[model samples]
Target: MSHHMTKNHPDSPNGQDDISKNDSGNPTIHEIIDIRLSRRGLLKGGAGMVAGGFMSMGLSACVSDSSKTATTAKGFSLGFTAVAKSLNDVLSVPTGYTASILYRTGDPINGATPAYVNDGTDTAASFDFRAGDHHDGMAYFGMASGGSGMDLNNSSRGIVCMNHENINQQFLHTAAEAGVGFSTAARVAAQIDKEVNAHGVSVIEISKAGGTFSVNTASTYNRRLTAASDMDIYGPARGDTLMVTSYSNAGQKTRGTLNNCAMGITPWGTYLTCEENWAGYFKRPASGGLSAKMATAQNRYIGSSSSNGSYGWANPTGGDTSGTGLYDRWNINLTGADATADYRYAANTFGWVVEIDPFAPASIPRKRTALGRFGHEGAMPAPAVAGKPVVFYMGDDSRGEYIYKYVSTANWSSADVGGGLAAGNKYLDDGKFYVAKFNSDGSGSWVELNIANPTISGYATYAFANQADVLINCRLAADAVGATPMDRPEWTGVNPSTGDIYITLTNNSDRGKTGTTTGGKSRGLDAANPRYYSDLKGAATQTGNVNGHIIRIRESAKDHSATTFQWDIYLFGAEAGADATNINVSSLTADNDFSSPDGLWFSRAVPGLMWLQTDDGAYTDVTNCMMLAALPGTMGDGAATTITNTAVPANGNANQTVATIAGKKATTDTLRRFLVGPKGCEITGITETPDGQTIFVNIQHPGENTALADVASNTTASFESHWPDGGNARPRSATVVITKNGGGLIGS
Candidate 1:
């Protein structure tokens, strides 16, 4: 969803393009100028942290020197100084590190296809054989050779699967020079075909021959699952009446998966690629008057949009199927009268957690519907323990949506390691969906979303027909059960060392709206989602948790499958210039303050090494989105702080004045900004080999804010930043490998 913050693409004639999946209603939050720190406080705090001033230099040298490098009390450490915050148009890293392009958009999956020309002329047919754009959540899996030279955790030969969230249309064709729109109907149709082929996940075989990793395009393991690939639908929702469509009459299959964002690697060796922000791709006619039930359900999942879609593929003009070809199926509104007659039920087929067997190139992907369907972010699993149920923690990824957990009905067994979808059936097909409810006492409960629950069964407005209905309308069901609505929840990660679960609650400007606080129309701040403040970034005013925060929960006794858990706010994002006590809750200085914590991962290879990434809109005025490394402590390591609101009117439209309370805070030594990305890009999708020497990270849509007119120009000066492929090349979304200077483990 970070890509949503960028400028709209020129070819998007519909203006239906939405990068921030959902918009905040209040849009702007009021900042209290009265809360400013006094002269002495300013000299000692926030502004004093900035360099160049005499006292600041003295304070910076003495106070921050001890915390500048990433070091853990447990003894593992980072010797490099934090990467300097940069306005330069290139990737920035610590001095000893190096970054190289490993794979990029349109890179071939086979040797038969040549390298990308970077000039928008790559053929549409060739796209299916190429890598895709906006690289996101990915994973590296070791392939055991079972011979003399290789072991179970072999670092040399492995597979890398990446989620291609969506396409960057501006870079797809020869500089949109004559105007941004297409020149011909044929060109438009062909471009749409290419875009569809680039909208899912890329599975490439990578091998290290002379200590340098490269894509094995000729390897049979390389494959792509684009928007047109055939896929199977699994779980109780598989053949449900609501899922039947002309594309899959038996309700067992669907065509393609789109808007793939975050991901998870299953214990069975398959990869779970999540379908995110997928609803915008479909065009549903308002006049269709789809059933009351269908309308309610569809709205809950996809929400509502004004345009047909970013691309009018479903309702294209000219001769393809006379506007009713395989592409026409994207329009989900009623057309042919019955469910199986047309693609009226097409939208239901997506918004799923698609499972891909990275090892089996020919195996079709399956949509595990039991994971529930909202704007899914990622499906992060806790470690699989023998005799215990496998658990996956997930976030809904919308403003004020609920966090969730899926507990498998079946117990875990090492025997199912490579079982594939059959393993999915035994473990994922049936599970208990639970929503989180944080209480005042620093404890929380997982409110079950079971169809039989009284809260769901007795809900009068939205009928709960079955378990499938509850999962299909998960947001509605969570609301019906009174689950806590948090700021936008994105990625979830489980600490490999301590088993604490952490979720990135990206900024939500809608949280403290006129009538949305606790005593008001909507939910208010709780212990887990404590601070609710406004951010003022150059003339722009953003309120209601504008900088976002990360919350970590330790399941009861560290049992991942436990129903009740104790939670605390691990870190709150803020600007280095903001009020230290109010916004800079984590006590951050200019070196590490960040906003919109999006991608997070706990390194399995390097214990205690956690990587934090930013896909932000709030802090762009100060710096580009960045990636950070942290040595996180388990839950309850810091004291809880309280929040008070003085601007509340007696009418109770906003947050009312409340007593100060304490909340969880991270130790300063725990988190530090490791790398900052280039201009107009988000730092996302991270993976490292088992040995922890090579880390793969994605830099998405760099130079994305350039004007369409600039994009169409002949001079390279028209671009915001030509990066990765420097010297006038169009900015391309790519994955890079980060290696230490002399083969030391990452974050060391």
Candidate 2:
């Protein structure tokens, strides 16, 4: 049975001292979007079913008193509603705060001639060095004064590194509008170049003066590492025959990072950007056909034959068979005389963490092969402990995937702080990667993936040739090691003050209720993935952890190197009212209700301050996705609460409870929803000023619901969310800064 609830647990100060407090003594402000009696609460109070699966809880309240109690007790007072909206428009913040478009899709880099026009149609050559689309994970690293590491605390100027996740094909094509001409090779090449430029991270120097920040566009540090950029593969996996290609004489280094998602920064001052959902970029020839082994591998990476090629790179005229090497490289189907003749390693190059030095413009980004490749969501480093090995946590984003950690071979040292890439070479180039196996009895282990210790070679389940092979095909190795499967792990954040790690398991529709026979691959409700419920929008309906959960993992020794950890469900996500037995894992009230927890972060300024962002399809009926802030108690603060699976009746009652919070119900005293977004937008990626006075947050993909044809007009207004515009206007994902009128630490 799952350890659903904790019973009278002790409150140990494991990672507590690490939590930051607001030094400026300013009160925080909170605004509640909706308040009502929940349908589940009504059902438990004796209500019957209603039509459309939305059991209405009478509008009897407005924000829970529990939320106010939690906030006041912590000395924080929520602030004004700076950018409320119904129509799709860019978000804006309160006065004294300002925001500018630092970079956007098709923004030119590399000192190119005829700068980007901001239109969709940019040439391939111009795009080879331009900014990519869909900015996701990012980091800000302060540069040392005099170009040396001695002035580490100085923040005069810093490198701003941001990830370009993916492209919007519907927005990219002019022909799709005319519906006459087809996408050609040149068009595909241009798209590929733009996408490549966008995939990896862009490092640009940003400086602040007079309370405003601007990018030093011409700074020598400005560089875009894209899909076509040359990147060296390091670690035991480097130079493996599987990584060989006609382009690489050494059979190791390869081109580009793709689908770069969330990121991590090392203690040594290097950036770690991860690749996710990279499998759809290529196509295999149908007639020639891939060999059995090759097909299996290809299918494992990408999907089945029915999956359409992204960017139309497969069509001959679209560049799949052009005389230029560009078009030919996308064909992963066995085409040439041998592996060396074609780009068999094309898929192999992506899905690994690419490390770059923000200070070194001339240095090439290295794809660290030691961190076993998968659908890498993000890599988060534990606080550097002196004389101890540095630990990095990661998650595979696919459903039923695994959580992973990599421990550096060398121990931490104060000297490594400013070492940059050289420090990465020492710590990250070689390391031990382990996968987590969470037990139901409130304990977990980090199963090592070392080939020697794992005896992977002798394992009968799957064949492993060497360490390189093990790292290259990490999922198989993880399965062999019996790693616990998770529910679509996404971004991860660590409480800088407390060592607790927070992971977002976005959502899994195919879980629990779906009777797919893929045993270990298809999962049901367990302690870790307790919720199993469905939600409704206007017409769309979704189920199975429809709302997600935030899981906090605490190392047993209060150190990241420890093999054992204690974990607890920090929050359960749902609408104001839903099935209490399934959706309300932590007994959350209306003030803190949410769904599909995605972008999660803890404040660098305030140790206990946690920000939760939602990327949801389940609760669109009430509002769009949103962001919430919480002052969470540590892992051992609450008693374990039992969670029952109402949707999947036969799952047989898995138990879960708040282990440490004695005499406390899952109420607003613990969590509160802070901000909600406009229609069809995911509120994500938040940062604060060094003094904690100013806050910067991103509102991504506004007007995402507007059709391609409706691009000419302000379609977002019809949907009732003209956010930054406040009226009928187009919506663009933009960052906004928030600062108190009195200029003090935020959320104090």
Candidate 3:
């Protein structure tokens, strides 16, 4: 999850912090956009969400002060005792559940392709037609049945699409060894080609027969979208000057999608593959940095001033000039004789919401830039009600970032179910964008990001010329408004049985790091962001909210497009041995304790059932990351909690020593651990069939801690795990399908 922290992508400044640069455009294009989120409150001097630990409550979203229980809370039991934690290198489920390998890295896609050899000898070219590394965020699109759109109940046969978040270098090459960079290896063109081809998303067909699920590679729907595939641009910014590349002088086209993390499934039967941490993958020449127009844009998202990236694909020891535009594409330095001559504008094409149709392999993907670009974690849609505007909730996965939402101009309808890209035009594009502001007092507001608003137009900190400029430089716009900064925001999930939406705030080490955070941002404990602590892992001390927590919100009046919301902390992640009063604020026991809430999903087939997964470091000493099942109660079920942080203080800020936080608590009967993964692994990427009888989950980067020196001997003993392919063999990122041994509904 923090892979970007280790690698230096000279051309990509995706996660790095930088100041804004210059722009060349007409100064009056902001006239055509929507601006209600700001005009109503922010522009009129309305108080925004602030940095306070707690505040007195005064209002409500739906339920009144007398009772905080949501109208749709589920208090049913999970029905199973929690699974025991273990260090074994295998996927474990409840005793009645069985699991099998569905697919793994290097696995072939069609009948002509051979099986995965599970070694480092496979040809780099072969990976172009195989499953990729680091599987993440997937959704099941039921069979379209030839033009009637999709039947959500078609559980027998369907299409599955998933993201290949990033690469695992040690296992990706033929002669990988410690101390030698995979991209720096001799004659790395082939190796570079393989990694690039394997970094996007894959669409495969799956069908159930008798009792097992199998991939039908021969199906015409089987396909792969690499980082170099041709795609069209959509939304108001599609034909703008910022997108004028040699590939599309008209600024209507671009190539490939990169760093795809979490994704979303649309009600219109399409999939939204999110581009995350995409800024730091390219390098710009120092001289090119002089072009304030381009540099200004790059600095906002962090464009490195070097000529190489994490892999040196553009400037490898072996000349990149001989390749089929393959190697040169990685370099975004202005050395390109012109926009067309070099990939100077190539970086502009990435970092947007990419829409793909899994049922139609021949269809071109569209980069919907109107969604307000940043390090998009994922997009989760509110319940789609006919005649109502579709609402999508998204999070920017970075430290001290803001949460956003997009409200479509078009209303929902069944007729547009199979409309495909046309449906995207009706909903994904031309929307009102707003950032969230959480108040310590339970109430929160959605701050509009409209340039026309006086709050934005009157601000002199940054330049906002038009709607296109506003969308391109969204982070700056969010900052101009008083959006509440948060911990590392990850995946978001919404309850179908209830209108409540939940977002996972992964741990943030910098929270309350120093008295003065230096960047004008405060890291002190606030009512909305309550906990701050330090933890010891081995010899290193992990600080801030080490275990992380989950926040749930209900829209005012239960309306998806409501500008206000009522929220509370749903659960606080922690180790079973942690203090119940301070660390384990949710009062979690051995059966429900967990940390670093990362991946979250609601069972589409099982109403009221939510699946919670983790990607942890603070508690690995006890067991690896795992997934849990919860029958969640409403946000107001429990009383507010107060934490007295007693850690070493820095900067000018002293120990809070006392901070009262408000949030509901989770009981053992309401939530229980369902499965534990192997050592050195993260449990992520989850989905299930419409019937809820079969579920698919990804085990990413297993045995990732193995040192390169240990793997040189090429033995299973050199690694920390080899389950799912037991015996002396290398471990691979794989998708496991789990089902009840007696055919019961999952989580039933």
Candidate 4:
């Protein structure tokens, strides 16, 4: 899995647009104010760690230090740091370990299919059933042998379920080389198919022996779920008129899932993959032809044509007139006889948490509508409690969106163990979705999204049509209920040991801006999102809640279904040299400083060991994206401290902090940088064996350097990153597994 192999086109200064030219100038006054108030309250009020609370909890495993020393205790050794220059570079680990590519873009998983050519020309038919690209969040589920959940010690064969976030056009096609100029309708179709194939999850069986792991290519469990695969629609929105189509007369089923990002596995053995950035994959007709209501919906969801035509799928066939059915699907226009006859079905299909059974190859993944959808990042289930309902936490990954929780209607029972579709029918098909609203007094309420609730039914803000509309347009529903908007809520990870939920609020730049505010939208900061500062180095260009922060919520009764909870900020992202007065919240220093925290996962085997990975561009000038492992204490670490940003006068509270292990300075040792990635590579999608002996991580989009010509030889060398290539070579986005040579637990 070399980064070079992932490049479909040579590096060039005039590369495909990266910053999403879709920017409609600055956000509208309403959008700006909505984001401003949400961020202000989140950071300033609700997110502070209580200083002295966790001390008596017996979690004092370490103290701060000034030197870089590998503190080893209880047989666990702090692993060596691996350096990667970019997304294309190969992984570098400690001397005793080795790495391999278990899977990559276009890898066939059905059977005797040819290996991926590592070029951009793979056939679309083949990709219709193959693994997707930009692998993100993933989980490793040990297979059950002769019934009961596989014995933790005897489990040698397991299913590796990984999410294919999005596609990289430069690495997937050769538009420039094919003499087929990029952006044409035909060119866009090819790119669309390639991306559509690469957007779901790949479930492959993997085996480990002699301290090394490899894909069991011939295993029956190996499966690839592409965007074309038919999936069942479940929950309140299922079978609704909004989802009906000629393709699905029942209206309870959809064609496929797209933009599948981070994922989670339920205790019952089902995989939950989320859809993020799904809005960018659709294309609405130009403004003049659309109704005002329809136009507003289209613009609100996807954007205008200036947004690049939703991957160009509508181009080749006829630019919405392409008679070819394949090309016509991407054209989200209303020209057909009716909504069912046109691509309106496209909008109805995406944006839900899809459930897949890795063991059932013939099974169609189900889009669980019960979990209200809107840029779903990941779904983490709380440890199952006997007789109680299953609680799953999720985040809507967008600036000024809300966090959500789904409580299954069915109670937990041992009979549901390994129950497959039946279990999903019993639990996932019906559930209550709730949104978080952190109060100023430190307590929070999970407002139920039920149509029967007065807050929802009697609300005068946004119309509460029905449960279907609520789930389909969850952001609006959350806004109506006054759910606290967050700074790009990305991933949510539940501590297996404690039911505490950790959410990554990847930076939001719209906060603090003032303008004509819309109904139900506030204009200042509050408790949940409370920081506003300009990066010192690029102050002129950057503003708002730039660095971002991690928020942790503790349920009052340790019950996932509990509506009330306490909240705090685990850590505030900033540069090492940030001014203590404004920037430093947890009092962080050089050894561990980060920004735009994205991918987050908590090890089931290692209770206190939480892993944090970053996908960032704002702080790239100082350091590349990274992954850190933390031995975090439970909630209540810092006292409430207000954060005041002159630009946006918001009130923010500080979270609890302890001495850093790297330096005796008072900070949050509960979070620390475990690994740093190569240049331009986002360190994400991590999984480890149940024993914690083997770990697998994805290094995505490595050599994204901005300059390089079409020359095959020269363009490859221009990018400074060559990851997974131990000897200064081209980088490739691939998965690498790190295990101890002596066959011991990782990070131990």
Each prediction's whole-model lDDT (CA):
0.72, 0.61, 0.71, 0.64
Q: Residue 370 in candidate 3 has what lDDT?
A: 80
The 10 consecutive residues of candidate 1 with the worst lDDT sum are: 54-63
lDDT at position 184, candidate 2: 33
Residue-level lDDT of model 1, residues 1-748, one tens digit each, is 1112222221123322222223122111122111221122011222233223322111111113323455677677766556556556666655555566788888998989988887778887888889888889999988765422112387788889999887667677777522566433223667778878877899998888777789987788889899999999999798887789887789889989888888987887789999877777776765336567676666555544433655666754564564334776777867787988888778888878989988788899999999888767899999999999999988877666778999999999999988877898899999888989876556788988988899788876578888887887777788777777677788999998889899998876655445543213253454555555554566654556677788888899899888899887888887666666666777776666788888999898877788999887666777787898888777777774645532323223344332222334444356666777778788889999898888999988787776666666746787876766666788878898877767888767
Clashes in each model (backbone N, CA, C under 3 Å)? 9, 47, 22, 79
Per-candidate TM vs. native?
Answer: 0.88, 0.82, 0.87, 0.83
Candidate 1 yields a Cα-based lDDT of: 0.72
Sum up the clashes in candidate 1.
9
How far in Å is the alpha carbon of 213 misplaced in model 4? 0.8
The lDDT leader among the candidates is 1
The segments of candidate 2 whose C-alpha lies over 4 angstroms from its true place after superposition are 1-101, 107-116, 128-130, 144-152, 173-188, 285-292, 306-308, 316-324, 453-455, 517-520, 648-670, 711-731
Root-mean-square deviation of Cα positions for candidate 2 versus the true structure, in angstroms: 11.5
Which candidate, 3 or 4, has the higher TM-score?
3
Give residue 395's error in model 3 in angstroms. Answer: 0.9
**For model 4, what is the error of residue 373's alpha carbon versus the real structure, in angstroms, after optimal superposition?**
1.6
Candidate 1 global TM-score? 0.88
Candidate 2 vs 3: which has more TM-score: 3
Off by over 4 Å in 4: 1-100, 128-130, 144-155, 175-179, 184-191, 286-296, 304-308, 318-324, 458-462, 516-523, 536-540, 646-669, 705-714, 725-731
lDDT (0-100) at residue 624 of candidate 2? 59
Per-residue alpha-carbon lDDT of model 4 for 179-269, expressed as tens digits? Answer: 4435534555556666667667788887777655778777777777877678888878888877776566668776667777778777677
